[model samples]
Target: MESRNPVIRRYADFQKPGSVLGNNQGRYDGNVITSTPVDETTQTFPGRTPAKPGERVVTMDDVVMKSFAMLALLLVGAFVGWNAPGLAIIAAIAGLVLGLVNTFKKNVSPVLVVAYALLQGVFVGGISYIYQNLVVADGTNIVGNTIMCTMVAFGTMLFLFKSGIIKVDAKFTRMMMVAMVSYLVIAVISIIASFMGVGGGWGFYGVGGIGILLALFGVGLASFSLMLDFQSIRQAISMGLPEKESWRLAFGLTVTLVWLYLEMLRLFAILAGRRE
Candidate 1:
């Protein structure tokens, strides 16, 4: 299945046919199916010892635990960033660079992923502070509201996806890709406009009804991106990927959740700004 997630799509190990993952099915790009049938009796994968009796494989529990671990690290970083708000821009830039590295790295490094979580947390925390203190109206509780919204969105999407209410097929993937690309272009332009003092320094996202619409669109995009992450993790588990691959899956989920949170934060901030 084609995935728009940069983290999932960049995994070359999953695509390898006769490689460590065994003679599995086709890769993520939907090409190069291995002719050799998988041996049911024997299980072996790279980056770890051979599957022993009662040895663990990649499971939902593993992914969830790793995700929580990363989230903990992120929260710690966020605390530091919240205390020292001046590190916001620097953390954002560093987080972006680390994110790109983690995304493109052939082998998953738990250390690097953990580092990313912390740095990303700092960026997120700094931004949240700015929105709550300087951007939103007094007593708006923008951060609290945004966090609640993000959690709700995540739960809603997971329920919809697992209950078959949402199906991530090729058609759906294509549509999402198009929408994501278009949104990215619009976001870039809006940022530039904001820098140039347009839309009262809020860019296209502050132009009355249009700005509200754009913020809603952003929230929607981030929300739907969760579905993609869910689908990818489900596929990875079904494929019997290595246990270590859980880090990569967790990283992808963290990335999506962070994006969603940021989107919600911005939406709340924009609405609060309008009210003020």
Candidate 2:
């Protein structure tokens, strides 16, 4: 998946031409990097040594930049859509288009990603607004609360990583991967059941234990996904990836955040329904 901070960084540095030395200038070896040769034969380094080895220079600049940009765009779209579901539908369609464009394009485009964010925002906000109108009064605030909770969880994970409270080793990754895939399978089955008119196996909002469990499960998967994303981004930086792929990294992060928020929203709805 194309996510926030990928484990692999694109090395734009590799695009730089290699060093070439001329035969006549072979003896002119100095501190300068001019194309001068040191001997009668020309010396050229088509392929060189390992790139930027042992560099642990991971910066949060890329994450902050892309995330903020996407958030801002999304807010605007969401606000508009919240007021009008029609607009939300359009935004959703546009978002789908932009998402495809971003994923399939050979080159990454920040504009497209930002556009996609806006569209998704509209759809989310509009849906929240509709939920408020359809459910009990002031139901829309539920979405707000869900958003806050999701943010808190995301920040918690980040802080844990930064503070070294979490161990992100291969074994841990393997466990998480297995859990995530299994969770996805369960989700797919639940969706199919729902389509077949099977109510969460629970009466009313309870939709049964399956519904409630899936809601909570989504939250956990999304939160764990964030850990994976941050780790990937950091490794990419150490590997010295190009800056242009910031959009790719940003796209990944956006996906996780969205998934996390949606899960929070669903979990909240479940809790709210139980109270009623």
Candidate closest to the true structure, highest TM-score:
1
lDDT of 2 at 13: 21
> Tens-digit lDDT track for model 1 on 12-107?
233344443445432222222223445442322334332233334577888999999999999998888888888989998988888888776767
Instruction: Give each prediction's root-mean-square deviation over alpha carbons.
Output: 5.9, 9.4
What TM-score would you give candidate 1 relative to the actual structure? 0.84
Model 1 lDDT-worst window of ten = 25-34
The lDDT for every candidate, in the order shown, is 0.75, 0.62
Instruction: Give the residue spans of candidate 1 off by over 4 A.
Output: 1-4, 8-56
> What lDDT tens digits, residue by residue, belong to model 2 across residues 182-261?
77677767667666666744222247676677778779878977877676566444333345555666776776787788
Deviating ranges (above 4 Å) for candidate 2:
1-59, 136-140, 200-206
Q: lDDT of candidate 1 vs native?
A: 0.75
Deviation of model 1 at 60, angstroms: 0.8
